[model samples]
Target: MFPQSTQSPPTSLQVHPVPFLANTQDADELGAGSVEVPSWQIPDLVVECPKRPGARIHKGTSLILPEAGGDLLACIVRSLPVLLQIRPRWILGYSMAVDGVSLRTMYRQLEHSGPCVMIVEDSSNCIFGAFLSEGLRPVSQCYGTHECFVFRTPRLAGAWRTEVYGRSVAPTSPSQIEGASVPKPESEGASPPAGFSGQKAKYFEALRKAQAPSSSASVFCNHMGIVVGTDGPALFIDQDLLRGASWPSVGFGSPSLCTAGTDFVVRNIEARQNRFGIGAPNANERPVK
Candidate 1:
């Protein structure tokens, strides 16, 4: 059985800012030759509850898909069993069209404080994501290999498929979280800082070489996704999935990859914090009462 929390889930949670706005200044610093920066801003991604009409999921959340009404909702509903496995207390950020930079930025903001759920879509619009237990960290920081829960609801399928990926390790400290949350520093065209090399730097270097695709060489690939999303992606946290079953493997990457049975729950979305910035909501729109 899942361990009960003596403390109630917090009423509010923080929503990591979606870094979709292009940072041309930093791009130039990295010698990004001729990469056109966008002058206009995109719409804010928001999450809403259909059951609670017009109810803002959490202020500063990404945009809700009004047209994604039926099948999508049904898919989420069917995922209840899987969602309950990991009772996420807070809602981070949700997007319909997400890129590698945006995903990395959110992780940097998280600073490996907790776990998160990332929903991905492919060229074919196949929908899936993983329950990142240890948050986003470097592959070298990982022990052996980290583990994450994966789920999928194919465009044509009605039910969802549950699986696990033990390809990532857990974070050692809260500070280990990268600074990708900010666009400028990450794009400054510098090498990984001191004491962050060997397997980790090599792994991250591969990502830099890949030019930041939807899925890079990091363990984020297992949790974030391998297939890029056609539309902005959605992300958040779910409750721990392994309740009755013993933890599939011990140590960060001991058994490496293990799988647990699939069962599911009703999900609750709570407000965390809203990021303040150029593309975010005005100051007045923040700290919703």
Candidate 2:
């Protein structure tokens, strides 16, 4: 009211009030009009780490896996499924040094349902472990999904060499040979029939297919300990939890985990579980392999 301007207000200088804070409806309208950008398309995606440069992502101290340098831990995390790639707070569920060397005790400590990583450091200093789909328990029948896998980390100077062995996909089943024609055997020391060699190859191929282990034999546990394979266990931890064995297995198709030999003396064993919920399956529900 100080001075009434005779000139018309500038048409180009219209004053539009701007909101300092958007209401829920305004936010919703903005979001409805926006398009989500793909993560890969974004440049310089920054991953915030702890303030300390040399600090570890896993909070607690670990024996087999070093806390300061997370090379081995990174390998294990990379091997995990996509759903489990979330930043994890690894809680030590069981440690042989702290919890005592008892398989039953280990089972008790890991009774709750969730995926866990079992690490074993043998006498030769070779590090190996298995990613269990569910908590460790004594089950009469083989129980576990194909998510179970074995891994071995060989000690190398200034580097971590990790070998991961996944479940085997058996070859296609051989055709029905029940009523198939069989090649007649020739006289001893005489040349075989014209098509005998071909038939022999087919016979051996069929035999090998029959011997391959099924996917259902993923994991088995009893009163003794845990077994990874039915035919020849890729990894086995005894009741004492002091000794273990590894061998070439048709189940996981893994080579011997222990560098020393098939049997290995457990130096230190550590079982770690994610603190955050992983949406693991219930005990009653057997996941299809």
User: Once superposed on the true structure, which residue ranges of model 2 sit more than 4 Å away at CA?
Assistant: 1-62, 67-69, 156-160, 171-212, 277-289
lDDT of 1 by residue, 1-289 (tens): 1123688633422211111122223211322232221111111223321112233433433322222223332223222333322322223343322211243444344454345455543333344454455454434322211233343433433332222222334334323223221111234666433333244335333433343222221332334222111101112122121111111211112111112121112122111222222443332332212
lDDT for 248 in candidate 1 is 20
After aligning candidate 1 to the native by TM-score, how far in Å is the CA of 226 from where it should be? 7.9
- lDDT over C-alpha atoms for residue 246 of model 2: 71
Per-residue alpha-carbon lDDT of model 2 for 171-238, expressed as tens digits? 23323221111222354333332322454334322332344345523666666667665444567776
For every model in order, what is the number of clashing pairs?
Answer: 37, 0
lDDT of 2: 0.53
